[model samples]
Target: MASELHEAIFMAKQERHKNLFLNYRNLNNFPVELLKDEGMQFLERLFMKRNSLTTLPENLAQKIPNLIELYLHSNNIAIIPQAIGELVKLQSLDLSDNALQIICPEIGQLRSLRHLRLANNQLKFLPQELGDLRELETLDVSMNLLRTLPERLHQCVSLQCLTADRNLLHCLPRQLCLLPDLNELSMAANCLTSLPLDLGRSMELQFVFVDNNAHLKGLPSYLYNKVIGCSGCGLALQISDMKQLCLTLGDVTVPLPSEVKAIGSESERVLPLEELACRVLHAAYDWTCKDVKLRTPFLMPKSLLDVVQWPLGHCHRCSQPMFTIIYPKLFPLRETALAGVHRSTVSFVAYCCSSRCMSTFDLQA
Candidate 1:
């Protein structure tokens, strides 16, 4: 601690200043000179970036007590001082571009902290207590040696951006899909092999960067639409096509109803919502062009009925739904060689919404 800095503290005390600016100093040790006056007790912010600090004061809490923000970036810090947990009111703490190896579990003690930056460090592991930061919003842990993140991390429901790119992570925690407010996620250059199936439907995710994982199999086919950057992945050709369609009008498919999964185990496991929408819309239009005098409803197997549902959609022609007694109908045809035209035993299911909308089709007829 320099005598000039020591005198500056005394003057700050007399002036009741709440901030201390000691950045850009070539100090190799924490300024113990400030501790000479308990007047430092009122300090709420500390600016000590771009210094030669190898460590922070062990009794920092006792010396300053009221720090709400601490800027210690661009330092030679190898260990996070344990006294850091004593700052209960800390809202922002920047420890970027350091040589830190271990972060104390007591770091979870900062209940009010919202922004924490630990980028460009040599961290090999993180304390599970990190999940206790419930109010945390932006967590930047990029450029580290982390292989995996704690599942308890999902507890930070307020987290919006999770940047952990350039790490050695292999698999992502499924709990990550439970974060309802997560909007941006970056996991590029990791050792990832696969992603959670429902990561696409977790929230209003706007930006996701999972490119450059050589071993990653692929993401769920739906995620391609929600994400903006997905190059360098190994997604399947068919899945890649559907991903593109979803980016346009894939109508995004949904998992097969539980009842139908085992029966059609060898076929497509999911069905597109657009297929059902087009079916009813086109059927409604066809019902109008043809003179089908009688309308009737037939019974379906209880197993099939359990999963069958008419997804809501607008009519294709007039856009008016046919919900009347004389409108929308269901026609069932049994398996036969020539019942319709195909020489197979496959059943045909037709549905229409209403006659009014159907009447709009082939008006020139």
Candidate 2:
């Protein structure tokens, strides 16, 4: 086995091969022959999956500076050397199914990285520096021990898909709703109780999966047609168990507010001053904010501007953008198709802008 591995490496060096495959080698350590003297500068891709290698060389980048792809899946690697950040040209990296506990902050320096997979690890937290990957498009951190994802992750403006399923996540950062290019999100089998009210408001977000979240009692109105999987949700948890889980998760258990603010009806004619102002500002922003010429003089205070930009949610009935306040109505999960064939009973909270809209609102409609 050693002779065969050495022969393969020698042949690759002689031919100046751009790609090297050493998968399923049962090797317990990185071959010293590969890193001796000046490394394979011409190497562009390296495949070492299903190996017994436990750690990476500190001079891996210095040896193979041109690496564009690195696949180290199904390894016993526990720590990624700081030199990993030196792979400035690395575009794809897969460290899934390993024993990694903490990701080094230097990983954020991979400016050219586009794809990263760290699934099936023992990671308790990820570095906030991950947000610096402006080119990152897909991130998978599934099957870990994470309690929360970085709030700065919203800075990954180019991100398209994010999966953090089967973890200890109690709540997701509301800032994730700002990702303009994000399309799919999967956070199944967690301990979530509620989701951000503005989630799924983005036109690009078309699919969401939150199945098996036993504590998730309700979903936001914006996810009406977008939610893909929500089975095994709304399962009642014993008060003692709930309290214990909350304590275990620490401050991450603060679920998004889903209480019924007010029920709209035909009898309520007087709209609150705050609500009316918000509606007016929202309408004005929608109208003239798109036209540069008309937008010039419509200056709003920073606080009001922020509120109008990120509204509480949209009305479930009329699809009208709402800010600060919502006239909420609740419906049993069984009443909606989202429940599918599931036997568990949960509820979906619908938001309305006014009493008039609430009077005419229907969960089925």
- Computed on alpha carbons, the lDDT of every model, listed in order, comes to 0.63, 0.73
TM-score of 1: 0.61
What tens-digit string does per-residue lDDT give for candidate 2 at 144-222? Answer: 9999999989999999999999999999999999999999998988888778989888989887877667566556767
Q: Which residue pairs in candidate 2 collide?
A: none
Q: Worst lDDT window (10 residues) for model 2?
A: 253-262
Which segments of candidate 2 are over 4 A away from where they belong?
A: 232-365
* Model 2: residue 26 alpha-carbon error in angstroms: 0.8
By summed lDDT, the worst window of 10 consecutive residues in model 1 runs over: 356-365
lDDT of 1 by residue, 1-365 (tens): 47777777677778878888888778788877666657377888888889988987777878878888899998999988777889898888999988999999999999888999999999998899989999998899999999999889999989899999999998889999888889998998788877787776765776777756656544553353453343311112222212221111234233322222223545432222333333333333323334333321333343222123222222233333322111112121122222233112112122221221111111011
The TM-score of predicted model 2 comes to 0.65
User: Candidate 1: where are CA atoms >4 Å away?
Assistant: 1-4, 231-365
